[model samples]
Target chain A: MSFDIALWLVQDGVTNGAIYALLALAMLLVFAVTRVIFVPQGEFISYAALSLALLQAGRLPGVVYVLVGGGLVAAALDIALALREKAPARLPRIVALYVLVPCVMAALAWWAAPRSVGLPLQVLIVLGLVVPLGPILYRVAYQPLASASVLVLFIISMAAHYALTGLGLVFFGGEGLRSEAFSDARFKLAVLDITAQSLWVVGASFVLMFALRLFFEKTFYGKALRATAVNRIGARLVGIPAELSGSLSFLLAAFIGAVSGILISPITTIYYDTGFLIGLKGFVGAIVGGMGSYPLAVAGSIGIGLLEAFSSFWASAFKETIVFTIIIPVLLWRSLRSRHIEDEEE
Target chain B: MKHRLFTALALAGSMAAGSAYAEITIGVSLGSTGPGASLGIHYKNAYQLMPKTLGGEPVKYIIIDDASDPTNAAKNARKLVSEDKVDALMGSNGVPSAIQMAQVAAEAKTPMMVLTPAILSPAVAHWSFIVPQTTELMMGAIAEQMKAKGIKTVGYIGFSDTWGDLVLKATEFHAQAAGYKVVTNERYARADTSVTGQVLKIIAANPDAVIVGGSGTGGALPHVALVEKGYKKPIYHNHGTVNAEFIKVGGKAVEGAVAVTGPLIVPEELAANFPTKAMSLDFTRRYEASFGAGSRNGFAGYAYDGYLLLNAAVPEALKKAKPGTPEFREALRGALENVKNLVGTHGVYNMSAANHNGLDERARVPVQVQNGTWKLMK
Candidate 1:
């Protein structure tokens, strides 16, 4: 039974689900701090993946370049955003993140083109930059628009997503690039082939995501961010600096997204629109995990990944069909039950 | 928006007012928007190429945009055949859209041509001919070559989509039939970035070789990932996999990987010194000049040929037409069937009352991507 393809499918599903889960958990971070859906989240994933490919190809020293590129993009967004306010001291940080656009892209272009960094490196570059985007956008864009309706924020999220997707296509071209993260490595069994690269990426993502969860929960910055999520005004009164926490959350999410992009690029070719599906699936994972719950989002991400893998393994043909069909039924059931409970309470 | 529109209207105004024709105006549908529409250039050029080469008189040509949707492709095909009163039709750059267009063309009996690599389940047109060297045909050709080389054991990886399914099924069937050992078959989502696990599994299986069957760069993804992880094996690539972009992304990884393509865009020197001597070369040069390099994938080759094929039909129809008669349009339809040995970018194209697809494996030329450029198969 353990040797059956079904068992293999289960294992594969779990592995893939973990990857998706981490991405969703990152998305959930933004959702918890700000109410918008952040549709642009997927582009960040693609961007991060592209960035990683660029850096890895150029043989830039380990995780440092990823960190440096991400930090520089975030810092640039902060400075430009700070300048947008009539009174810099009075303005909120969330409204200022859009300033990172030209900077983020310029940094990426510098690494990807001209430099001729390989695919793995491009993936890293995209991965690194995307991690800071959601957070910085929140710091500069969201804080100023806090009094506005969620609809306005939703539009902002959509606009952000579109801007990135269009820009990516114009700059990167429409085709998916094959990453050189893995080129010449192979070991074979009866019907199973595994590469050292795939294992390393998967394993690294696992360790990194868990470590992220710990940082967001156990660390002081993590607690401050959580406090801001629960009672921003109160946290601000208590000197928690609510905007900074929001910034931290967005940055954390972007980092995870970047990591996810780099790890996944060798398997999924990174293209401009790579984010749409990943973002949606990541959002779905976050919702399934009850939203704003980091652990649950991670768990939910795993569920989505496994479900996708199983559907492909068993049904083969109706993999996507099964995902949407099952999701619809479950969503309908949960939302209906909650609505009935609310009506009774009323 | 205004800039884009002005460009369109300016081009249209220059080519405005078509020369009057009595033949039934057939509506052709393809990508009218986005990256897929890039092929429309070759489609337009094909109309211009036919007159001088085949001595075809002018016929009204109508092209429709499907907007990159299969459902939209169906609507476009229907509108062209039913509403526009086009005598014949052709559409789709690849599998998903082609499947939908094929259905619309069949019910309408529009004698449609699908210029894609997708295999239509049960031929779609009353006179539907899929363009030659279909993705399956081309892949099958490579598989046959592999069999001849005694490279039996194989691994397959691709994105989980329609085109991928075709490559997986066709390549597997042909490889197994040729006494090859099956080792690994895997698929990743379109959004997946890392496929090291799947590639590793294939590597673990230790197949004699790998057959990558996915459209665009997705096919070579495992190759790059595998090599980084230190896997070594001969890899066979399908048409869409062997492009400069994919090779560039894969870098030093693409060498030694074999692929299937057509010599659709031949140099002038390669063309036969016949009347339409440099027709194919002219098309290739013009297409490259207009579009960037790596724009001429396998699909573009057939699409260019498809237009020329129809344009040639126009002249034959004019010869058969009784001037100033309604019967002239009917006569044009009758003349289209007689087209044979009309050399296309692939090879001499032929169409009969019973058959539509014009070529087979003989026309497919397998090439290996060495370094960054495509190298013809040795």
Candidate 2:
């Protein structure tokens, strides 16, 4: 490739890398906190983009219903738990958090969805519709099986992914939808021209990553989540609520996924099942990063994105196979270097 | 014991009557949901326009949703044969699904009309009948057009599956014959959200024209990417872009692009003496009458042709053997194989024992995207 063409490919790679990096960070965060790999992370991303597309088209999105439906189910679970524990005080908080908040959000969204509003409101509507779904899903599926084996949790995660994919089809029809670009302006970079959307995707992902770092390093809730990740039983004994950490981690992952969806939606069409493949790419990054380290995952994800771009340039037919193939050597290297540990008897 | 005897007598009587006046059930397993639904919906709507009675027998259509899954398509085909007792099978969409159903048709010794383009050899063509023009016909048109336009070099981008392989192979064959050099080849998954890397590589190669081999809304991505990247070369697409959703999703990016599709997509633009004009317009009139104005696409034409093929062949099969029997199905298959000069929505079919598709140049017509609508280019 010529120098200018190579430069353009790098820009494309970096743009995709930014999105993958955000997903990788989310995967790392969830795995670290919950000890469960969140597989439906990309579905939230797709839902975010699809919700915005609906909002922009002056139609109320189906995600509002998903949110309320999830909220109602989670509220029922909380109410049942409260009754069993004889903790009447927990019922009011659960009602306010799950029932009242989601209902109000849904009502407000319905009012605003039909209006020909600007892009900012449209984006917020998408985020509002997508972010809360993570925790609600956690409450409905993961919370009940908290003490299960990792393999069991993994299976449940896969089931939830399939369920979410089906629901994605129902919520957003089979036709792929692309949103209007946040910005379409292009700037000349020496020999190559780069669109403002690429810059926005890269800038937004990094900003979100920095914000996440601040949350984990500086905030009390973040530290509690970290502690829970470090030692689940010890943290529970020391008054760190494990469930709160789990929910918070999913909430953060949802935010990351939703933002990435919005960023990438303009560049390409978003479909119901699109997120699964994208999330799988991010999972590769997570594995390369040892599945827990944030910075390593970020770096690994960017490398993957670049490798994918180059591979597509070189042999487009085998690009996916090439990208996925990177994990094999990394996995082998890890397995060969590390000793296998036996699980304790239940 | 008396009740059992009466039930047996009733079943025997019904069986005798069924042979005399058969209810010919045609089972359709289509992708009514998932990504294939856009085209599948059109086929489903077109099937509604079929006459209830054909060949002096009540025709029953048992349509099921395959969800674009090949496994489901095979299962649905098996169910239609064994449980529903359908005499013939037709599928609504996707090549992989059609290929799977073709295997079921062969095993059950039933005739199957496939609505999508698939690579069927003479062996597979024994049981399967392709409705859409093969990839070779469309790519040949594109290559001829490119050569006529004095385009010397081209770039290729397509799905990374059998669909892609077929299109690529077709392009390579035709382009080479036209003495055109293929500068670059790119592939991506159907659900991919970006084609920047592929588009960039294609641009770097700097060919005179680009041909994208993808279906439905997903096909529009590369066009958008090309436009955004400021590549001004002519763009050509496969027959898969004949649907309304491609135009809707593509918008300005797809404008000025050339495509090859069934004549039914732009019947009004066809010449008065075109072989498919009279029948294609008939289909358009009936389809729009029910589905509303301008509701027809090439996908609907494939399904309509499937119905027409059966309508002609079933009556001839009835002359040979009675319906609701294995002899009748074998006769139907035989009749379908020998169909000659039967005009349908897409083309004039002349099915021989060897050629199941039975369509020549009449089945395909060149078209261009103009002012957000398909305009006949030929």
Candidate 3:
């Protein structure tokens, strides 16, 4: 390849790498806080992007119903638990967060769907429709199994991924959708031309990453989440609610996923099950980081993006295989280097 | 009690005899839920619009979702043949799944009409007749277009599956005959989000034109990537990429993109003298009317043509044996093989002992995306 072509490939790799980095961060956050792999993190990305596409088409997105239904189920579960515990004091807060908020968001979506409310408002509406699904899903699928082992939680996560993929097909139909780009500007740099959308993806990903760092360092809730990640029982004993931390982490993860979806949807067509592969790539990055270090995960994911770009150029048929095969050696190396710890659950 | 039992037995025996000649059952397995759902849904929709009877006998279609998996398609085919006792089988939008169903059909000694252009082994090809135009026939149209345009070298990008391999093989097969060189052979996964690397390589090769071998919405990715990178010579697509959904996803980027597809997509533009014009128009009208305008796809037309082939053969098969018997299936296979000058939505089919997919150049028409719609290129 010539230098110009190499430059173009790098731009493409970095742009995709930025999106994968955001996903890796979200996967890392969710896994750390809840000990769940968050296999459905990519579903949120597809749901958000597809919701935006639907809103742009002047149709009421079907995701609003999923949000409302998930909310109702979560509210019912929470109310039943509260009632069983004879803790009526917690009922009002549960009703507001799980019941009232989703209803309001659904109502907002229903009203804004047909108004042709430009791109900005439509994106905001999509975020509203898809973001709550994260915490609601946590309450319904994960909270009940909070004390379960990691393997069991991973199994639940896989099940949730399949369920959400099915639901994605139901909501978005079988067709893939690509939204309008956030900007139409194109820039020529050196020997390569780059679209403004790639800049937006990389820019937004960095902003979100920095914002997350600030949240973890400067906010009380973020610190509580950090504490929970470190030691769940100890944090709970010290009056930090594990359930609250779990839900909070999922909320942030969902926000990150939604942002990544909006950023990339314009550049590529996204289908219902598209997120699983994208999310799996991010999981590879997370594994390279040993599923813990944020900086390492981001770095590893970018490396993966570049690797994928180069490999696709060299051997397109074995692109996925090459990318996935790297994980085995990484796993072996990590396993050899890190000292094994006894099971925390035991 | 004994009198009542005797009366019930008599009624049951008469009911069985009456039901025997009442209906013919056809089992359909399609990937209506997974990766191929976009095309699979269209194939399923065509069944809803198909005639309720075949050869003056009422017919029942048992449609099953294979979720785009080969194993599921095989299981569905077996179940349909054994449990549903379907006289014949039809299915599946993906080539892999269709091939699996073909194996099951061959094993079960049932006649199958596959919707996709699957290259079956000679052993199984006798039982399963391909409904759509074969890859060789369709890609030949593209080669003809390239030769007419005086194109020298071509860049190739497609999915890394059986479909991709088929398209590449066909392109290479025609390349030698057309006096053009294929410069690059690149492939991507169907679910892949980007093709920048592959597109860059194609650009680096600097071929005169690019031919994308992908289908469904996945086909739009490489075309759009090529356009965005300023590769403006020409981009040609095979029959698989001709769909409303592909256009919807590619939007303005796919404008001026050309594809060779079944004449069903441009029925209104077909000449009155065309053998399949009337049928194509009728099928397209019914399909678009039911699914809404702009949903006329080649996959559905394949299903309709499969029905037409079966419709023409069912009467001949019925003369030999009853509907549900194995003898009827064997006869139906023979009858399908002997179908001559059969007019359907896509083209005139003439099946023979050696050829299963009987479509030729008459079935394909070159179409270009103009002003957000497919316009026939005369």
Best by lDDT: 3
The DockQ of each candidate is 0.27, 0.56, 0.75
Write one digit per residue (lDDT tens) for candidate 1, span A245-315.
76677677667766766666665577767777777887788778766577778777778877876665444
**RMSDs, each prediction?**
7.1, 3.9, 3.0
lDDT by residue (B274-376, candidate 2, tens digit) is: 9989899888988889977766678888898898889989999999887667888899999998889989998889998878888898888889999998899
lDDT tens string, model 1, B192-257?
Answer: 544544654675577888887665666666776567556676788787665566676666777777
What does the lDDT read for residue B240 in candidate 3? 92
Score each candidate by Cα lDDT.
Answer: 0.63, 0.85, 0.91
Q: How far is B283's C-alpha from truth in model 3 (Å)?
A: 1.0
Over B1-378, each residue of candidate 3 has an lDDT whose tens digit, in order, gives 999999999999987886776589999999989899988889999998987899889899999999999999999999999999998999889899999999999999999998999988999998999999988888998999999999999999999999899999999999988989999999998778789999989988999999999987889999999998889899999989898888888999999999999999999998889888999999999999999999999999999999999999999999999899899999999999999999989999999999998888899999999988888998
Q: Looking at model 1 chain A, which ten-residue stretch has the lowest summed lDDT?
A: A337-346
Evaluated on CA atoms against the true complex, candidate 2 attains a DockQ of: 0.56
Preferred candidate (TM-score higher): 2 or 3: 3
Tens-digit lDDT string for candidate 2 (A285-323): 888877768899988888888888888878888898999
Candidate 3 chain B worst ten-residue window by lDDT: B14-23
What residue runs in model 3 are displaced by over 4 Å at the alpha carbon?
B1-22
Clash pairs, candidate 2, are: none
